[model samples]
Target: MGESTAPILRVNQLNKQFGTGCRQCNEVGSRQLDKNYCTACGTVHACQQISFDLYPGEVLGIVGESGSGKSTLMRCLYFDQEVTNGEAFLTPYKDGSSNLFEESSQQQRYIRNHLMGKVYQNPVMGLRMDFSSIGNIAEKMIAAGNRHVAAMESRGSELLEKVHIPLHRMKEAPKNFSGGMQQRVQIAKAMSNNPPILLLDEVTTGLDLSVQANVLDLIKHLQRELNISIVLVSHDLGVIRMLADRTMVMLDGQIVEQGLTDQILEDPQHAYTQQLVHSML
Candidate 1:
């Protein structure tokens, strides 16, 4: 069969509930939980599956209110945390297989180092705060086995310029930069290795509108130029509409709605999704 229309980043019956002990063989009482929800009262579900077909050069937005499991799902897919059950496949167009859900830690490490890139919620989450902005990004490139890694001395200058940072400030600590600039640095770092997939979690949360627009535009520009698949974790509808080709709406740890951006925006199917759409306007 050819590729299914679903998505390259496929989640098959994926479920995650934060609790103690193994997925199977754990006693319910010892595992702390009033319900399926986390102790924080995040929602829980009997069957929470997250799947989408992320063809090269498309962005998928995962949006929902706080405690809606957007971050949980992203972290699960990113391999920062384990899924309760099911699989997440990260298939590349020209690659042999996705295997993001592979059992081998070595295989996971291989993909984490080269096949995937991440932008976490906090600006510094994916960056080395102690390092200069450019060095932060360059270190990732070098670690990815760029034996003769081009002197980031020049490339870093160019990237800072591309992201609208002063080229001369490439050597400045990322901490010296404001929140917005820190976010930009994180973006720069995420793009350094040029992974086929990017997991962006609330990338513009604290940015001003102008900076947010700039960052969003930079992402759009890079997506086109790099032809990378992006999974955006955000609460902003405007950002989602502008950046996503499709959207996944989660509620109570379950996907209430999912489909093409226009479909979900114009005619949301679920009650929760409808509320999200109406609230955006």
Candidate 2:
């Protein structure tokens, strides 16, 4: 759980806006609209002035309702979206000297391949539906320069087994699997490279309660076994409580509060956080 130490990843003044900065946008920004959408210039501030540190083996949970920019933050960090402003430093990348946002495309590709793993809320976004479960896991391993077919198969099989996916189903395509199974395949693929950090965006969002419990338990087990830092984003406090060592509460495009998971859940200080905690009661 990292306890107390320097962070493995650091983000400073991160911002992501989907529009040009114009006088109209300035006026709208000055008005401080509660929603991210701007009525004047039609810009969307998906993330604004976000900053955080994620220590090794620590699970940092980001919780917010739909359109709250939690997913956007994950996308930006994973290089799925470009950052409008700010710097991100990953300890293993370039010795944490250069901001990851400023890296070359090739460097970013290498970083994503070897250093970080991501599992999106939608399996469609994370898995290649046409690819077999083993093939999907192999794709990430190949990206990290794995070449031996036998070794890849062994590693892939091990990961799938860890996630409770049947060995007989390893050659089956994810499209043929159930939603929970597809998500498990995604998790197995994300862990293929044994990355130091993992980003999970609502990984249990649409599952049945029983299925969700299984997936969540798998995640907790994997975290302990892998000792990887994780940034978990979910609207469900229960999920956060089950997985996160620390939690951050977000609203609109900004973080309203952050602290130890228990502190944030049990003694919510912000009004929105209080409302969220109350609803869970």
Candidate 3:
């Protein structure tokens, strides 16, 4: 199954809405929402009928301006936010028959610990700022069922080294680290479980240009080394260009265009996508 051409992850008609389904909100069709918001019912149609596939060892990029629902889509996939409606499947879960969104909380927690890794745009969202760097990674391993302290400690040390975090700081809290370092630690913690799919949301958003380059390089290297399927969300085209194998351009909570990254950049088909491409030039 590892070498099968089937996608590692599949999503269908995913939707996330933040409001009561009042008559007023129901009257505002998804197509009519302005910038993902409905004026009539004050509803935020964060993600509307989003659908996509992520293949093994593929870097699938989701790009959109703020409020375009890219981040909302990620949050939904990671179960950070509940999906109002949709189906998500992991190839390895119940032999691909189970819908992730419908799983029990216990089952969802297990899957989150053992099957997926998520890195948030903000370190505070991903890391325990008050905990030692080693502690952060250990928390993941613990969730994955590691009971031996010595083994977890050793694993944490090794992952920290892998992410280029200095060993001397293993006992230091991440609150004292720079933004780049905090992100590295977050990556290390996310990878601790060795999940087959990684969800990264704006991992390089606020870092220095040089730091962003280094982080991007590290991601590429790890993708090759681990062969993990990656879902990367970013508004930055350059980041998408540098990493994604395929790109999806989103607008107003809809996928305006999607294709090979180069094709999307060089021959955008949608008006919104064309505008994005032209602005990048």
Candidate 4:
């Protein structure tokens, strides 16, 4: 076995705020002024002084209630949104390391298309509702320059099997599946290119408890076998415990507490974390 090492991702002093100038940031007022409060209609601080690392094959869960900017942070890491300041890095399980923000736009696009994948909170949004599940996955594969359509088709089937979705449903539109099934299909699509890192945003939020358990199990199993790093964002501590090796607790755009999974779970530090734990119990 390979010796355990450092994080696959490292971020330091990451600061991102919406809008332009202080006057604009302030016009919106103090209610929105994050501690790192920017100077305009600073809709959200998004993230600030957010330093952390993610190891290869480790699941790093981001826990924050709604409006805490977890999604925005995730988007910034993937370059979906602009990051105002600091370092962001990712060393994939397969490729040379890269500074996500420092890279050229072409390089960033290449990484987004070929090495990283993201799943949205709502499955419906992750896929093209008009296309069949197979079409959706294959279309993405082809767009990413998977030259052989046959190989991609075969791979898509394998993915479907892994997710326990029936092969026959491949040609069927995702609009027909139950919410849980749709989620599984989206997982299959996201994994189509075999990315080394995945962003799972509230993947199980809407499912029933039983289905949620199964989805969590599936995510864990896939992570182990694929040797992929994952950033799982969830407000649910139970979900975090099920999949994360480490946890980061965020409140209003800042990471208030972060550490190994057990440490955070057994003895949380921040008052917000304490309150969250109390609410859960």
Candidate 5:
């Protein structure tokens, strides 16, 4: 990722909050709250004024503990949840001139199908458990307007092979596979449409150590081979250290620190970041 290269994805002041705000918590400068929660209004600010750029072929890691809003940020980007207020621009969409949040629902669906692919932390969220593994990949391709059965079948087989899923078992449902295999199937399905941007939300979480290593290796290899931009969200710094070029540390629904992954690991600045680094040590 060259610094001179333009960002494939740019987000500005992205905010996602639940519940209506009261006068006490509505004020911009004077709003006081417990962490990300507004005490007076009973509102939870899941993401607050989040902004970042994802360059082509770059893996940007968002690291935070649970409830720190890292996953929420990913959800907003993938259009799984609507943003309260913000603007996101994609270079492949309208030359980055239009804010994706303002686009109609139909247009947003187009963006989701063609421009972005997301693998959720849970395989169930990303896959149809009852559908065959290859069928899941075909579902995504079909959503992207692929109607040719032979082409979809060929593409699905290639993707399954890319993720190291056995070709013989391509007809099996995800529910019949182990956790690691199911996640791999999800990866294949997500990549089926050849999306430019991939969102991975704790993709390796809840797996055995060996399984986690295998999944991480698959993602690393696939990202390099495809040269796709990735926004990887995880609480594990070890995972970020292994995969991310740059890191953004979020705390209380805000970015506390951000810099090159090596720099942040060596000399963390923010108090929360320092604690995180120290914990890893």
Candidate 6:
């Protein structure tokens, strides 16, 4: 992605916190908290002034340890968790003039169905285990107002095949599939709407090493073939290295470093990021 290319998605000053803010924690620039939490107020700032731009046909990786707010950030973007405050603009929605966070729930639903797709870390969160793999894909299509059964079936089958899910088992529920296979089904379902943006939160976590590679490879292939923009969140730097063109390092609910993947790997500036890079070596 070039600097001149307008961002497909832009997020500004995003914040998500739990618990009511006390005066000590609400002092803004003067507040001092332990990491991202306030002992005095018992408020956990999951994400703080998080901002970034995702360009078209690019993969922007967010890497951080657990509790560093990477997953929280993803959840906020997907509207799984309501943000305390933020503004996100999507070029495809309202000409990028409206803040998505301020949109009505109905409009957000439309955006989720037509403009973006998300594959959660846990398959249970993304898929209805009781529904057939094809049926899961059909559910998303239905949300997008797709009414043609024949078209949905054809699209579902095509997507499942693209993700390497066998057509023979398309009618089987995800509960019967292996962890990796279930993840693949989730990916297929997320892509069912042919959305421009895909949000993947730890999609390969908990799988065997071999399975991880397969799922990652499938994602890379799909991104190239479809030219879709992706915001990929993972704790594993290796995964980020393999797929992300640009990378952001988050620590304590803030972005500590961000740049091209190669530069960050070769010469990390932040102590936390350096530690993360060294551990991957």
**Residue 134's lDDT in candidate 4:** 85
Candidate 6 lDDT by residue in tens digits, 20-45: 88998876688789999999989998
| Model 6 poorest ten-residue lDDT run | 23-32
In candidate 1, stretches whose alpha carbon ends up further than 4 angstroms from where it belongs are 1-7, 20-47, 93-98
- lDDT tens digits by residue: candidate 1, 1-281: 13654455666777676544343324433544433454444434323565556666779998888878888887877788777777666655234354456557766666776878888888756888889888887887787766554666666777778788887788899888888888888877877766888999999988889989988999999888878889998888899999999898887666778899889999999998888889888
lDDT of 4 by residue, 186-241 (tens): 88888888888899999999899999888888988999899988999999999998
Query: How do the residues 1-281 of candidate 3 rate in per-residue lDDT, one tens digit apiece?
Result: 36659998999989889986556555535345557777777888887778999998999999999989999898888888889999999998897889999999888899899999999999999999999999999999999899999999999999898889999999999999999999999999999989999999999999999999988898899999999999999999999999999999988788888999999999999988889889999
- Of 3 and 4, which scores higher on TM-score? 3
Ranking by lDDT: 6, 5, 2, 3, 4, 1
TM-score of each model, paired residue for residue:
0.85, 0.96, 0.95, 0.90, 0.99, 0.99
lDDT of 1: 0.76
Better of 1 and 4 by TM-score: 4
Q: How far is candidate 4 from the true structure (C-alpha RMSD, Å)?
A: 3.4
lDDT-best of 3 and 6: 6
Worst 10 residues of 2 by lDDT: 25-34
Each model's lDDT comes to: 0.76, 0.92, 0.91, 0.82, 0.95, 0.95
